[model samples]
Target: MPWRDRISELPECLITKILSYLPTKHSVKTSVLSTRWKNLWLTVPSLLLNCHDFPYRQDEVILSFLDRLLEFDPDSRLLKVKVECGGSEDIDGLRDRISTVIQRGPQHLDVESFTEYRDDDDDNFLYPFIDYIPLSLYTSRTLVSLTLTYSGLQDPGLVYMPCLKSMTLVKVHFLHAADLEKLVSGCPALEDLTLIRNMNPIYADEKVMRVRSRSLKRFRVPFSHGKRCRSSVKYTLEIDAPVLERMTLGEDHYDIIMVKNLTSLFTVDLGIKFVVEFGVFFYPGDLPKRNEIRYFLSGISSVKHMIISDKTVKAFELYSNVGMIPKFNNLSRLEAVFPFKLLQFLPAFLECCPNLKHLILEVYYSREMEDAFELTDVPQCFLSTLECVQLKRIHEWEEEEMKVATYFLENAAVLKKLTLSLTNYPRYVSDEEIFEEVNKVTKRSPACHILPDWGLCE
Candidate 1:
């Protein structure tokens, strides 16, 4: 007998509670154990059916299982359904099951189809994952969060989720720009939105995708490395969100993204490795001109914290010739990844961050970068406000590194903390020469705390 047989002897309510803790698949699998466990999962509030989890099962078997599972349980209240499966498999049954769950007024709904199409006859696109989404989802008043991924060949016509607070669409095809924009505008209470791929059409009469929202606070745009080569149409994204607080663009994608009237925004993360070969009009980093780059930065000038990758640093170099970098008056924390030898431009960048209190540098060593730390004068933060510094990937002790570290130590009046870590994993920083050189630097601020524990890493 199984160890759980004793626990299964508890009352039906207690057994259902235990089953609720398990995933929908595992809970349903318990039916084979005994008659008592046959319908326990139906009493649970949520159901998650992932085809990947139950490998080698025929589509008919999966559909039959769902047919028995979703059969109307009068006692069940506030349903949550998540179905992850191949889009084209058992297409009719998948639609029926989804509709059944929606009719029950789900509080959270996620339907993902990993279906793919690779027909050479239609060679224009590589990934043709598609699903015809049901119209019933648009008008759901009970849904708090909705995530629809890899929806194929669907119009996404007129979404009206009045109670939806969070939404995510990945590889979901839309027919028009209005369809994409209306999804944002239609959700009256939406606070978070994520648009990953194919939410925009391959070509449109209009080159603008405008999203105007008052309640939105967080947004994300991510690009998949594998799908980068797949061709798609380009359009400038014009976002006008009054209360948005965070925005993360995975990479500086080819399309232009413009933000306006975002007064509450405080966090912005720009990922690395944008295609720089695109035209000057599209990608700001493509040329020495400042117009595109300047517009992108100025939109989030109110950001209080930022994380920038090396690609952005290089873009800054491209745009450095024409104009002054916008001063981030509210910025307090900055984390920058130094992939190339652009540390010399640190002083110019720091000039824009006058109120910055904490700074983190992640460097991958290049010999050219050693000579690149040329500061014409001490930055404003080094002299007064900058309190904390985190240095990552220090494999060897070099002159430029020491010079920059010593400069901060000698100049900063309010320096409170300094942390140093090595590049290699098992992540041991046992270089005595580094400690010896840094220890020799003059301590201008006695109140400054230097963390030397080898385990300390950022």
Candidate 2:
């Protein structure tokens, strides 16, 4: 047999695999390559179409392209399909074409609209005139991931995706928060979800914002404020995901009540907001209760790694009992921006985190006051398993810094390495000073390394 005849014997799976990586137009062009390749594009499992693939001067060009592609393989079961339109001609016809494509039971579908030039009347064309995402698309038992970007999703409640594992909604608005909650609750197998309210004209109040996902492992919700709305809406998020592993609460200032739920979480990133309010002047004896500290610590007991900002430390301490702090028994890694109050509570805090190994501290600097807090004695609650410590922003090798360094050098039995970073100035503590301190303390430990400018290492 000739070489051409031998090449024609390649398996269909290999041909489909080759076509899957190419653009939709390129994949479709393979139909004319040979008689054997004529129907190969029909079996391709993914389809992606962009406006630049066809000439935009003619309004019917895209429509004709879609018709031809669908006609070739109207019954193909696609794993993913994406269609992005550029010009505005017949949106109804486009929706019908999309509905026809989605009816083939694509496991993943994305549809978005784009234009090179901004139209003065673009605001009028923002709403998606399409009625629905046809029940046939959602009823597919194989659909695992679905994303709708910049599409008008008026009624997300009517759709139900049983096998959907991950979903992202960007610039999409729902008629009601309950409808959104219903949509999330309906997905029994959903593991990751992202809802981004970016640049939406419609605004909902605090009470109307809600979320409830039982099987969700990761959730991120970011809201953008318009000029008309200067203040952000506050809402209470009652989460009940028992199997959640990672969670991120964005820059929304609202009380977070974890309900002591989520036993499977390993990482937590909380963006807490703090405010000071003036009320009736009470006697110094009438102070606030300290249960807030207990509440915050109990919420993150299962987290092994935590990252907190500076502003939240004071609020956390104020809400806790006068002398009691939550014990983070399993905590191994911590990244925080330390405030003066947190520094003062360090001895008590480290006592609870007995298993801490890696500590990354980003110290805040203020010109209003000198270093007032000092660590006079070594902390007795030092971690025996502590290995590495990365200190950032060493201003002047203050009393607190020296005390922390000396305590770690003396205590940290298994410590193997220490990295001290100095910023904003050069050589606050000379090499002689560091070596002298190490000679006085660290008798049997690994070498201490100092990086004058740690930012350059990255």
Candidate 3:
């Protein structure tokens, strides 16, 4: 083939489009392809960099490459900038350089640094662009989304971003919760916010900070702190967002007062710690008790879909008054782990949520059952609107298990499918025995399938 013909056959625009998805390093290498490709990377709309992508000693080379790319088209509208680097010294230098670049103000910035090693004297070894966030960059009105994952971040004051919409902070240490509250309040149009960290003591002078976003739609705050620290501090969230639709409460230090006024919520996920005795303590408390478990669930009266962790299910029985379980007239989906003893609450739940169409039971045993045929309290009537039943971990078809299956088959008039998970099979009950019992118990299902590994069911 003639060289001219080969060149003519190639589409320069198509080649540039393909190179746009490659990392900045690989994209720059395209310059060596031909003179026509020398400036191809400069026109690329996205840039991503990580210290691990290239040799550790090549920091200068990486920095020079980024500088040349930015210089090539200083006016270009960058859509994304991702920088992930490690090592304390590399991070400190990188932080300074990144701070300078951020001052230029890209529309989107995602910066993460993970280096746990410290100097021999116990002082933190700072890496490039790791310790401090470029405060000047937060003031940029052009930023639409920003995510930062670092070790310790002190208070970031009332930094305003008129056009900012989404913000995510992970492993950030705030000097005061008010600083975080101030940052959220300053984003006039912020819509999404996520915070994941352990508990820190609230400042003495800091008032309970309330977040008020007129355009906010989703909020998630997961606590990864262990039991020791969580039990001591009370974390409170004050939200005044009329447009809020989805909320996820995670971690142990969260305050129960935040959800009381969220009148427009549609979906809620509560990650409450399950302790039977702890739950019983709040059964007779005030209208909206201080109990973290009950207070979180009671606020979402209008939710259409609800997810409660296994811990929350075990704790529900602690409340002597079943009436505390909020009504969800519009609820259609419910996912929860069921304690064997809590099986009795199924009937009451069905009565409350008449429109529920799906029920997912993640059965967790208290201990190994010695007598497989022991009967437990199983709901007698099947939910009329239930169309599908999913049972996880069906090793043994004890009398209680058979009674539960038979009740559902007899009462679920509109039921269409039943799924059984045979995880850890034969070890608990022989497959032959479980299959025979299921065949005898199930009556109105159109299809029934057994999955040895429940993870594959989805």
Instruction: Kindly report which residue stretches of model 1 are placed more than 4 angstroms away from their true locations once superposed.
Output: 1-6, 52-57, 72-75, 87-90, 114-129, 152-158, 199-207, 226-232, 272-289, 368-373, 423-433, 444-447
lDDT of 3 by residue, 299-381 (tens): 67678887877666554555536436666777788887777766666666556666788777776554554434323333322
* Model 2 TM: 0.71
Cα error, candidate 2, residue 408 (Å): 2.4
Model 3: lDDT of residue 201:
39
* Superposition error at 56 for model 1 (Å): 5.4
After superposition, the stretches of candidate 3 with alpha carbons farther than 4 Å from their true spots are 1-16, 52-54, 57-65, 90-96, 103-105, 114-130, 151-162, 198-211, 222-234, 253-257, 274-292, 320-323, 348-355, 370-388, 411-458
- The worst-scoring run of ten residues by lDDT in candidate 1 lies at 273-282
Whole-model alpha-carbon lDDT for candidate 2: 0.63
In the range 143-232, model 2's lDDT, one tens digit per residue, is 788887655444443556788999887655455556567777778899998765533324463234455677888876543432322234
Write candidate 1's Cα lDDT for 1-458 as tens digits. Answer: 55555787788877876666567988878878778777677777778778766657577777787777766574455467788885454444677778778877999988887555655657675554356677777778789998888764345566788899998987666656677678788898999998765534443543576778989999888646433433356656788999999988875443666779989998988873434334222244345334556776888899999988776777675566556689998999999986547667787788899998999877656765434555457788777779999876666656656666776777766888877765455323357766766766635556777665475543
Per-model TM-score on C-alpha atoms? 0.86, 0.71, 0.75
